[model samples]
Target: MAVEPLPEPLRPAGSGPAWRLRYLSTSWNGHPTVASGTITLPAGTPPAGGWQLVSFGPGFNGTPDRCAASQAGTPPFIRPLSEALLRAGYAVAVTDYEGIGTPGESSVVHGPAEAYAMVDIVRAARRLAPVSRRWAAAGYSLGGHAALWTGSLADGYAPSLRHVGTIAIAPTTQWGLQFAAAGNPAAPVNPAVPYQGRTLPVTHPGGFRAADWFTPAGLDLVDLAGHVCIEQMAAALTGLTMADVFTDPSAAMGEFTALFDPHEVPVRRYPRPVRLAHGTADQLPAVLTEITAGQLAAAGTDVIYTPVSGADHFTVAAAIAPQVVQWLEELFRRP
Candidate 1:
């Protein structure tokens, strides 16, 4: 593990005392890789067990190397939450995930890879500051999925760390819903669907060919995705439908399922407490999150599921930040 002061320009505005980190972690395909992140410590002195930690996962920013949170300033969606946690007297560790600021393409929504990066960042953060071994995982959108995966994987993957819980705000849960819509000729496409369309083949382990999946027009957008962040990609692909973005919308199901299914959240019961919150009006849909929370509960996870009546995707994290911080406080206070 390596640590360095985050260059002033690179640190998120108002992040207070922060450090940039590069640490050893595994990629989605199981190859050992170096991952990077930022650790932001509160202004005051530590408490009895040292400052508690929150391994924060930011939502989808983009897939390219330039879009990393530690490289690019933190995105608005998750910045409030991280800052809020810091203000609440905890150190926040935010991973850039599998390849955001590093060499290869980022895994995007690959849960385990992101989870490994998330859990390991806490380990790395501990070495940098006076921190407690007890930590919680939290994230928004795509990150929310990674946070939940961290809950399930943390105990086994990093036995030395005591993972107290997880908080997921509008996490992406059902890939089938999104992919099925993409496969439908008449379905309207969201930026994320096409975004994933461009990424899945490239990130897949078997070295899947992009030509087999995208039409010529889609291929051009795929090329664009490699260079731009989510906002730019979204603008470029705006108004396109599924038919415009895929070669044969129905064709990639086998590979798509193979690539994403195993990475879905609640892959097994979460032994730690979990708090899931989603906006009823989110583009990702609250129904899917509800279903996922149900499965986790049935599987013996100690989960509290809450749906914000009218909030949408972009606002859910800020809307629930106070509640989440309180929950984390209570969680860390426990035996």
Candidate 2:
């Protein structure tokens, strides 16, 4: 493990000393990879059992090394939220996900790769700071998806750590269906779909070709997805619908489903309680979270599902941050 001070932009003003970490984690294909993250603790002395930890996953940041949270500026919604978690007396550890910072193409939404990075960062944080064994996994958007996977995988992947719970805000699920909708001219354009068009192929095991999926116009913009951050790629692909980009969105639908299906969360029963929150107005659709929660509940996982009235994808995290902190407090209080 390697530790260094966090960059100025990523360090919240009132939070305690924070650091950037490069540690080992397993990739989706079961290969060892170096992962990076940021860790911030609450200011002042530790509590009796040391500060409880929240291992966090930030939303999509594109698939380049420069997009890693620790490398780029603070990710969307991370500063205020991290500060809030700090005020609530929890140490925060945010993973860059596998390959974003260290090496290779990042598996944009692969759950196993993300779960490994999330859980391992907690172990890395323990080495550098005073942290309680009891910790929870939390995230927003793409990070939220990672949190669900972490909740399902942590108990077996890191059996020694006392994982208390999981909290997902506007988490993504059913990605294959989302991608399939790209063929619908009526379906609203989502920049992420084009962005993933380039990334998913790079990381897929079957060696799928981006050329097989994208139109000439999309090929021009999606190439940026590999090189720039999400916002930049979104800007470049703005005003273009998926049909405008994909030759036939359904042309490679079966292959895309095969690649993305295993990445869906709540695939297995979570050993810990899971708090799932989504905004009714989120572009990703609230029904996705409802379906995931239903599956988890049916499998006997203790699930707490909440739907925010008007929150959008970007605002859902702030909408439920306070309640989420309270949920964490109650979860950690258990014996």
Candidate topping lDDT: 2
Off by over 4 Å in 1: 9-15, 193-199, 253-255
TM-score of each: 0.94, 0.95
Number of the top TM-score candidate: 2
Question: What tens digits encode model 2's per-residue C-alpha lDDT throughout 117-137?
Answer: 999999999989999899999
lDDT of each: 0.82, 0.84
Q: Give lDDT for model 2.
A: 0.84
Output the lDDT of residue 209, model 2. Answer: 77
Clashing pairs in 2: none
Q: What lDDT tens digits, residue by residue, belong to model 1 across residues 86-117?
A: 78888888898887888877667777888999
* Residue 256 displacement in candidate 1 (angstroms): 1.9
